[model samples]
Target chain A: DAGVTQSPTHLIKTRGQQVTLRCSPKSGHDTVSWYQQALGQGPQFIFQYYEEEERQRGNFPDRFSGHQFPNYSSELNVNALLLGDSALYLCASSFTVQGYQETQYFGPGTRLLVL
Target chain B: AQTVTQSQPEMSVQEAETVTLSCTYDTSESNYYLFWYKQPPSRQMILVIRQEAYKQQNATENRFSVNFQKAAKSFSLKISDSQLGDTAMYFCALKRSSRALNFGKGTSLLVTP
Candidate 1:
């Protein structure tokens, strides 16, 4: 009955460094999505994964990528990060059904700071 | 491309008072969904309410309700009996069919005593 969970609640990395953040979807959920929320702004979608494959992506660059495991967990990897990359990384999960609410329940999020 | 706009950058209301946050989205899809999400200092994105574009009756949950105007592409959230616990950033989001959510910049709400 646990909700979505994320690891490394807070991270500090330097520019040009690489970091990987992990997320575990809620029980019985199949879809996972990643978002980046800069300070004082709403979260912007990064990508979505279903069935271990990326289904949709946002306007992010090649430095950002993600993977979904068979167990519905996900990892977001950012390479050669820049200072602007510092933001709160949020992971959300949803149960995909024909008539269900399809609401994306979110985790507490990982705050990444690139120096 | 879809755009969600929240003109209100910040708002404050006394405890037990009611406040409304305005949101407007642009989309041609007749069947879509609008949502209100609350993010507290803890930084957890909580789903407050949802309204399907086709449902004209609006959606309500406890003290939260949405005034959804499909023709105008406007979805406003009203929080009744506001509590200090309700102070947070409220985001308006829109999703078409099964795509990802498009969110507004968000409105920071403060419920004062």
Candidate 2:
């Protein structure tokens, strides 16, 4: 039983460039959500993907987008990255059946550094 | 929009002692879920414990427990017999229905032996 897994443990990008981070949700899970944790701060929700479609989003702008594949894996894409985009990008997974009560298991997270 | 707040930025406790982290949240929804997640130096978010709005009994997991006050909108985590491994950044989060979790700034706990 593998937990949620993320690719490219770390990434480095520059302004105006785009980057894509990958995530494989825990086995038996379907919903995937992305979050950004800045230095010395808690994670802020980026968006959520369910049924291969974006279900809910946070205060993030259009530049932040995500996709949920049929296999329940997910990818978070950030376009035109800014220096402020540097943060730890976290992926969490849970089953929709339990709804809000479902415990969300997280991955190790990809550390993104925007220059 | 719902919001979670952790007033304490940092706290310290000696090994084998107990420590409590404070959290407060604002939400109009009568029914929701509250959670405490611990992120250590490794940066993995680990669920410590959770409380349901409708449940009167506080949630507990091993040495970790929560004091949930629905009317006061307060949720505090108490760690007993703390160890060095207990040191981490603890975040308080709130969720309603199918919405994404709203997390507080977090409180950094340091356990010293």
Candidate 3:
């Protein structure tokens, strides 16, 4: 089975531009989450989507949003991006099961450079 | 929300040697999960080991094991017989009912020959 896959492995955009990163979840998985990792820092949770709805979110601003498609894929969008938006965007997917601990599997992240 | 802390910013080990990375977390929720993820140059976060809060026995996966001290809120990862491929940025994370993770700053581990 193919693991989680992210598109546009590397992207470069100027400040105030919009960017969208795509992620395809692993086979048989239904939950998708997005995270941002700054240089030399751990990932910061952006948001999580489940069942085509946002189920949880972190401290990110409204400019950062996400969507979960019916096929369990996800997209993270950042509008009017600033230079600080430059970071590695990571996508993780997990199988949600009631009463079972979920282990998240991640994809090789998309590196976004905001100039 | 949970807060995870990885104290060691960097660590090194000789090939075939062992190294331990320390982590502590603060959380009010009794039901939670802890995890160690390794990110090499490839940039994919790979789960090395995991432990559930209610489980007293430590969690182990081959060369990787966790020393989970619930009372102290400490979870340390120990890698035995380390190899050059073990070099990576190791992250400690916590997750509650929301399923969103709180990650630590991470410890950069280097295993040299």
* Fnat: each model in turn: 0.83, 0.97, 0.86
Question: Residue A91, candidate 1: how far off, in angstroms?
Answer: 0.3
Which pairs, if any, clash in model 1?
Answer: none
TM-score, chain B, each candidate: 0.97, 0.97, 0.96
Model 3 chain A weakest lDDT span, ten residues long:
A95-104
The sequence of per-residue lDDT tens digits that candidate 1 reaches over residues A35-90 is 99999999999999988988899999999999999899999999999999999999
**B28-105: candidate 2 lDDT, tens digit per residue:** 899789999999999999999989899999999999999999999999999999999999999999988778899999
Error of 2 at B12 (Å): 0.3
The digit string of per-residue lDDT tens for model 3 on B21-74 reads 999999888999999999997888999998999999999999999999999999
lDDT of 3 by residue, A8-115 (tens): 999999999999999999999899989999999999999988899998888899999889999999999999999999999999999888734278899999999999
On DockQ, the leading prediction is 2
lDDT of 2 at B29: 93
Poorest 10 consecutive residues of model 1 chain A by lDDT? Answer: A94-103
Backbone clash total for model 1 is: 0
